[model samples]
Target: MNIWVTSWVAADDGVRLWTATTGAPGASWPVVLVHGGPGLWDYLGPVAQLLDGNRVVHRFDQRGCGRSDPSDDQRVARAVADLECLRRHFGHERWAVIGHSFGATLALAYAWTHPERVASLVPLGSTGLGDWRTPARAEHARRASAQQRARLAELSGRERRSAEEEREFRTLAWFTDHADRERAWAWAAQDAAAPHAINWTANRRLAREVDSWPEETVRARCRRITAPATVVHGAGDPRPAATAAALAAALPHGRFVPIPDAGHHPWREQPSVLRALLLRAIRRA
Candidate 1:
């Protein structure tokens, strides 16, 4: 499908966001996809195909990521502001938000702050609610091979790293199953390796802010979100499934669903299942 690409100043700070619209342009239900990696570019191009026929899908690179303009301010609040700016630019009063990984955390923040602007919320492979690093580390240790573990340990002990090294560490830390790991590497090679494809500086800064975020505050915000919410998690993901369940239960209108055997990138590992869940969420929304 042909995606309509455009660039707009999606923030008051003059950061231009590269955005694409796919699916039925006239669809009443407009859904915005927040890609994983607070820094991961808008690589949800393939995933757009699944929702394009029925719903209008919007995807954009967050500030300093992908095709978006570079900026020193990588705060989570800035990211939320960018989303609001996008909504206003699209003239949508309210829309459904589907976020993956760290993007899910952003989506939740936006929903909590502007519940009146969200029709529904779908958080996929979300983290940031608690001390996710502990469980993630445990899972990595359990799943990584001897070589992978050694490499991870070496990277973890480093006080600093180059962009490529950071990407490599993330690939190992995020994906457990061999196929998923391979796919992640391929994705990084194709998309993230390009010049200005990823803003590592911004990623590092924003990630620290996300990690420092208080779980109690996030849970408190989730409880106040009035919009319907669904937490979709891959069973094979490093983050514990209990976290997703608790997040869903915390929301006033929330449900949790886990996809068996799927890893972090469910779109690659289990496209059909993930697509089905997205459709269900949209229908209910």
Candidate 2:
């Protein structure tokens, strides 16, 4: 079994971000995994473990989230700069960049900013460029039952929630993110129990920055990035996979891969297929 080494990497602004890595330097090209959420911590440990044993894998919590130091400066540009700091600290000339959910957009933005430093790009279940949230919310609502919706509404309407109530709220909120509805409750409940709490401030700040970018602008940037990009999405995701296909079409060397009978987090339901796609991207990189 591969052993992971955990430590802190200081950013340009003296903020410390927690990072974990597996495998030795020079063994193979390194890959950095960026987890979803502008506010959530590094929860991509399973994704890292799924990679080839001979490859080095890196995971980190972004500044102001999880184990990282709290900071008022939470801009999209700042987040991109922090990622560059991590790369320079590790002394890598270029590395494969993989991201999930919102992290995927951030990874694409990073590549746009520093194309020369990205050997390859993988945006898994990315919140695609353009207005996808409305349809996504509609699909999520369609998937949720009346009782579940009521419970979610009640919890969200509250001024404060007990720990148990918070967990329940999260479970309900995330229940639609899996293809297997029967097991989604259990999986969402497990996810709700994650150790790190969401950083609402960081989430709001960075989300605003991301929203300001025009679709045409991002498309223009994508066209400039020459790195091979594979945009992966689950067929059952509330966020339409067509948006992901559009992102792929924007990139010069991008390809869109849809995972059948999967949702937002494909690896949770289709680990083997996701792993195969990831390995293919890494090998090509």
lDDT of every model, 2 decimals? 0.80, 0.89
Best by lDDT: 2
Tens-digit lDDT track of model 2 for 1-285 = 275678999998899999998865555578999987879888888888788477888899999999989989988889899899999998899999999998998899899999999999999999876788888999999999999899999998998888999899989999899989899989999999987888889888888888888888899988878799999999999998888898988899999999998998887899999999998887777
TM-score of 1: 0.87
Using Cα atoms with residue i matched to residue i, what is each candidate's TM-score against the true structure? 0.87, 0.96
**Clashing pairs in model 2, backbone N/Cα/C closer than 3 A:** none
Look at candidate 2 and tell me the lDDT of residue 81.
Answer: 96
lDDT at 222, model 1? 82
Full-model lDDT, candidate 2: 0.89
Clashes per candidate, residues 3 or more apart or on different chains: 1, 0
Number of clashes in model 2? Answer: 0
Q: State residue 177's C-alpha deviation in candidate 1, in Å.
A: 6.5
Clashing pairs in 1: 23-52
Worst window of 10 by summed lDDT in candidate 1: 188-197
Model 1 CA deviation exceeding 4 Å by range: 153-174, 177-197
